[model samples]
Target chain A: MRLSPRTWTLIILAVLIALAPVTFPSAFYFRIGALIFVNGLAVIGLVILFGYAGQISLGHAGFAGIGAYSAALMPMHLGLHPALALFAGAVLSGGLAFLIGRPILRLKGHYLAVATLGFGILVFIVLNNEAQLTGGPDGMAVEDLGLRAVSDALGLGLRTAEVWYWFMGLVLLLGAFLALNLHTSPTGRSLRSLHNSEVAARTLGVDVVRYKLTAFVISAVYASLAGSLQALLNGFVTPDVAGFLHSIEWVTMAVLGGAATVLGAVFGATILTALPQALTVFQEYEHLLLGLIIMLVMIFLPAGLLPSLGKTLRQGESI
Target chain B: MRLKSTLAVSALAMMAANPAAAEIRLGAVLSVTGPASFLGDPELKTLEMLVEEVNAQGGINGEEVVLIHYDDGGDANRARTFATRLVEDDEVAAVIGGSTTGVTMAVAPVFEANEIPFISLAGAVVIINPLNPWVFKTPHTDRMACESIFTDLTARGLSSIGMISGQGGFGTSMREQCIDVAGEYGIEIVADETYGPRDSDMTPQLTSIAATDGVEAVVNAGFGQGPAIVTRNFAQLGIDLPLYQSHGVASDAFIELAGDAAEGVRLPGTALLVADLLAEDDPQHAVVTAYRAAYEDRFEEPVSTFGGYAHDAFWIMAQAIESAGSTDGAAVRDAIEATTGWVGVTGEFNMSPDDHMGLDLSAFRMLEIVDGGWSIID
Candidate 1:
């Protein structure tokens, strides 16, 4: 029996995901793995925005901040469950994206980038300044998601981080599958068209404005989900989650791993997530190396690592 | 297929052979990278040096101190993640870290929830207030520094002062405390101004303060780029009025970064920096000299207040663990809480549950720059 490409991808992902845990030296590695998945989830959203739709956001961390703060504040203040707060964060992020995207998306290139930057800075300033409500710069506590309790009740033993790692990995897989499906859908086609040439897409009745807004809102939801997962996993939140540097780091991860491909984004996230641990010896040189990698990758592999490698492989096969 | 299967089997065999090892792991979630990188970088080095020192001295009660260090990149969320990992996975004996108040605050609750002992290098008073029994601080808080500064200003007969601070957690906290403490000294704040963290030129703020009527002295609070810039601005404007810097400028980096402008700048800080100026008979002199020599020999850099605090934090923890006779978090917390007359590189630490800040105003001395080095002012 032959497997279709989608089925083959799923099977491969499942095998890798299941087998990865076996190599852990300690449960510490599980927490790191969970961290990678949470960050990967955010990068996947960037792939939808930058890779598929050709939209740039320098402030996606703002949505992530909203998601994290929601997960933290709503559960404590409103007495809502953490899972419900995660949904509330996503909805809030979506609504924010909708309201801000309408005017901001109309601008092109650097103007749009600056406007989005402003929006992110605005959110960050609010979170940082509203000390009494948000616990100020000192940050606040987040409620646990109770996944460990559920596993305990079911007689399935798992560490706190192990559960979060597996859960987040499953969520990432689902997010990737949905994003891949969207890449081949009619709406995805319109987004790609608009990405290539907005004027031409408009002429072809692609409804460029609506498609762009849709992509922004969808990506915001993804970022919000990633943020909520991070808050849940760490059981804490702070305004720095929505800071400018974090926003840049997420974009860098997506662009570095070949934003055009789901697998590439995941690969990028994983590499970055693990690089700091591996480069512990080069303590001072870490930042220099990171800056150099970003520069070299942009210069040499403009389409990113995975996409460029795929192109080379295809050409070699043809030869 | 056979090769792949063989490889998989070998990988599984390797994993199974390596069992999880139990050690008294301690986590240091620090700002190893970012604008606050200087603080975290030295901290990491100091921590490494301390670990080596402890292990060389036969470890903590026969159990090796395994440090699980994480770079917060000066982000609070990353700090929290590292703290959680330390508590939930590494099962750290105590989590020590957070170069800045923001990161420390972010990670404190995780320590509180898990009942893991935490000690912060950040000097924010709120860090230990409404105190979680699990949390304690080594560096003197801003409130103490503010009180000391106000006392010094009163002695100097400077009753009217101008204020300038950077707009950040440390800066805002220090500024607020200074304002509150100034009233007790009958000191009036004639002018007040603030600059953002990224602001390079504080000339506008300084110039504005200089213009204020009857301002006898200027109190500048903030660290890193902000203090350096403020110092240069004060000098350039030819403001002969005495300029008082917060203890945040108690590093050689400030003198080097601020150039000639740092000369004559009065500041308040722990006794460590000016140990050489202390009488040879003073009890703290010997410890200070030894710490300075050891640190300089190790890192090839002059000892700053950061290194002093980091050294104190590690030594104090070691002492607590020794007193507890175990690595239990509760035992260590109890030992630390009951600390008294614990002489360290910084000052003699005396902690109680009511005051997690071990050192009070008496632990600090007024310092002024003379000939490009810190000198005892009073």
Candidate 2:
């Protein structure tokens, strides 16, 4: 029996996640692996918004900031569990996205990008100014999720890094699975059709605005959840999570990895996240090398790493 | 193919491990590329220079020193990851730096978890307060800066103060610390104002502060060009009140940015900034002069106080390692905790169970910008 591409993607992701630990020279690799998964989850969400729906957002990191702060603050303020706080942050981000996307998603191209970018800056300003509440720029510490204790009680016998690695890997897999499933759904088809030509999609009875807004809200939730996971993993969150740079990073990861493909987006996340850790040996020249690599890839592969490679391979096979 | 890939992985691991077992490895994570590079670049250079100096002098206790450093790009997440890598992967005896308060705070728990000595180059009270046994910092805290400035203000009989701080992490921290410590020094903050870190002009905040009743002096607590811009604005607005700045702006860059407007602006800074002004027999004079000369000789730039933090961290770690007599992380942590009366480029460090900074208020000197250079004030 031939497996669908979606099934293949899932299988591949699962296998990679399971097999990654075998090559771990030290427990530190687990931390890097978890970071990759966390970043991959955010990029997968961007695939839905930027790739499938063809919407531009330069302020997605604001949602991430909200998610991170929610995880940090909710436990202390509302007496909610850290897990529940993560969920609440996602819901809050979705609500905020829906409200903003209604008007902002109407814009096209760079106008939409600017609007989203302004939203991110506003969030950053608020987080920075509210020193008393959010601890301002010196990010406040977060309470532990008590997962280690629970694991200990259940005799799971896992290290802290190991727990984070498995948890984030599972989260990324679930995110990818949903994103892949969405690619074949009716809403997904409408989004793709609208992306190709908004006027044409509208003429064919597709609700363009609704689909765009839906994608935006869904992507925000994804970013929020990723932010929550990151804060939980690091045990702290700062205003940088909501800064314009972080938003650009997420979008860059999505585009660089083939935004349209779930696996490609994950690949992009892994590379971008892991590249810095790998470049530590370069010391001062790490930024130079990183910039050079990005430039080279963009120059050679205009459609991004995975898409360009896939097309070239397919063409070669056919020839 | 699997066997081949495994072979490659093992080969790479072996290559990473070939730095010789007798070499005492030290690690550092700093924001060497991004906005905080002004602070981190000098720090990285200082640590590298120190290592070379030590190795040149027959190494530390007959073991060559290896410094493994990573650039965190001023991101907290990157700092955390690099801190973990330094602890778990490189297995260094001690870790240093996170050039900004936010990055240092983010990585503090990692060092605490690994039980490795982490000596921060940043100046934030939170990095050491509520003391984590594993973590220590070189630079004076935001509270100390506030205390020093307030002490000066009180001494001048300028009890009523107006404050203008940037909205960055360091700015906000100093603002709060200033407010919190004002009562202890019998000072009253008559007006408190803040401008965004990126704001080119802080005239509005200064104007408002000047307009407030009983505002005797204005204190600006922020790093980078923010405080410099504030100084320019304060001069432009012609607020003749004694202008005080935080140690966060202890660099030549601030003087250049503020131009003639920096004249008469006072700040409490490390002795490294005005090494030549110190008495001939001063404890820190020798270390500061030697470090300044060596750094200028190598980098062809004026010494920054940020590098002095890294210098202190290096000497403290070296002293700890010498006292501990081993490369063990736990031993180094204990030795660092028990550190006392060790003179460094910044000040004489004296660590205890409660106080991790190991430097007193006297570490900071009152400095004024005369002409275009830093001058020590009595």
Candidate 3:
């Protein structure tokens, strides 16, 4: 029986999430696996913002920075649990996106990009300057999410890495599931139509501004949640989390893996996240090789790896 | 497809052929690229050179010393990822590096949890404070640098002081330490101002310091171009007060950036910077001179204090391995803690339970920039 592509995507992701650990030589791979899922979650948000809505956000890492700092500060200052801080950060990020997107999303193309970039730099400066509150650039430790204690209470012994791997895997699945459902929804169709041409979509009775704002708010929440999870996993967060380079990394991850598809974003995140650890074998020449790969990929596959590879495979099947 | 499969096969083979028990693996993660490369590049060269030297001389404790290294690109997440790979997959006996304080702090927990010795090259007290058993650092902590300057100021009877620091982590750390350590030395910080790290002109902050009452000396704490800009601005503004700098600016790059304005500026730094000027009887003189000669001969660049930290880290790890008589992590951790009276390019080392930073104020020497070069004073 032939299945729909979305269903196949979900099935493949679930099976890979469960069975890939069988190849691990040690528990260390679990940490890398968890890192991939955390990064994939963020890139999935990029898939919505950049892939679906066709908007550019060079400063999305700013929302991540807010989420990370919230995870570190809320529990210490407001006497809330780290788990609760995660939701609080997501909510706050969504609210900030709603407020900022109203004005910034009105501008098109590079102007909008610059406005978002300015916002990101502002957040980075605040985090760097507020020495007393945010611990400045030296970074501050975060309270644990207390998952281990709860697992012990339930009589399920698990390593920290294993627990995080499972937790992030579940979160990424939920994120991907939501993103896939949105791919066929009315809002998603409006977003895609506007992405094709704003004037045409507006003529067709689509609410251009509202759809764009919705995409921005939803993507901000995803990025924020990913940042919160990362801070909790590392037990530390720095101003770099919100830096412009990290924002670029998320975008690059989306574009590198075929941003239009959820599976592609996951593939992009996995490769980008794990490639460094794998490249350690190259030592000094790692950067050189990484640059070569990026250059070669962009030059050869303009449509990105996943989409282009899928086209090739389909062509081969026809042949 | 052939090339990809071949690469995978070789990788699998490499993993299958793990190091024998007779081999000891030492891992280093440094920002060999990106913004912090100025610090990490010298460190990477020093470690690469020293690893070859040790391996040439029959390795540490007669076991082949295999160096596993990765470039973190000065990113904290990359540093954390590399640290995990080093401790877990590589099975390194000890890990060294993370060239900046932020990167070091990010990976300290991984090394701590895995029970591996992590000798950081960065200068942050938080890495070892609250006492993580597995982590230690080679550079003098930011708190130590603050106390060193304050001690010199108090000795000179300059009790009233002012400070202008950058907004970076290093600057923030020193600012807090200066304020906290001032009361201990009976000194008063009359003025405190800060500038952004990218600010080319610190004239406003320096002007504020100059206008403060009873300010006997102005100290600038920062790395990169920020401190040099402060010095140039101080000279340009013709501030008459003595200008002090932290050890963060102990390099020829600072002098070049500040031009003649850097003359007569005093700071506390390791003896390695002014090795040739040290007295023959000085305990650190011979070791410092040897290290300076070897590093300059190999890398063909004047030795930096950051490289000296790596030099000390290498010897410290080597000494711990030799003393422990094994490649085991816990054994090496205990051996490093019990380290005493071991001298290196930086200072005489003595590690203890409470004091992971073994060197005291004695490790630092009062240095003055005379005619665009370092001269040991007092």
User: Which tens-of-lDDT digit does each residue in B303-359 have in candidate 2?
Assistant: 888888899899889988988899788888888989899899888888987889988
- Candidate 1 residues B1-378, lDDT tens each? 222332342242122222244456777888988867878888888889889988988788787888778887888766766676667655678877888887887788778877877889887777787787888888887877778878888898889999998777668778888888787879899999999889989888888999989999999888667988999989999999998888877877789998999888988877787877888887688888988888889889877777677888887788888899887888999988888988777678889988786786777789889889988866
TM-score of candidate 1's chain B against its reference? 0.88
**How many clashes does each candidate structure show, in the order listed?**
1, 0, 0
Query: What is the descending lDDT order?
Result: 2, 3, 1
Q: What DockQ does each prediction reach against the true complex?
A: 0.30, 0.43, 0.41
Residue pairs with clashing backbones, model 1: A131-A136
Q: Which of the two candidates, 2 or 3, achieves a greater DockQ against the reference?
A: 2
Higher-DockQ candidate among 1 and 2? 2
Tens digit per residue, CA lDDT, model 3, B166-278: 88877888988889888999989899999887888888888889999899999888878999889999999999988999988887788899999998999988898788889
Q: Which lDDT tens digits does candidate 3 get at residues A61-126?
A: 899999999999999999999999999999999999999999999999999999999988899989
Candidate with top DockQ is 2
Task: Name the candidate, 2 or 3, with the larger lDDT value.
Answer: 2
- Candidate 3 clashing pairs? none
lDDT of 2: 0.87
Could you tell me which 10 consecutive residues in candidate 2 chain B have the lowest summed lDDT? B1-10
Task: Using lDDT as the measure, name the better of candidate 1 and candidate 2.
Answer: 2
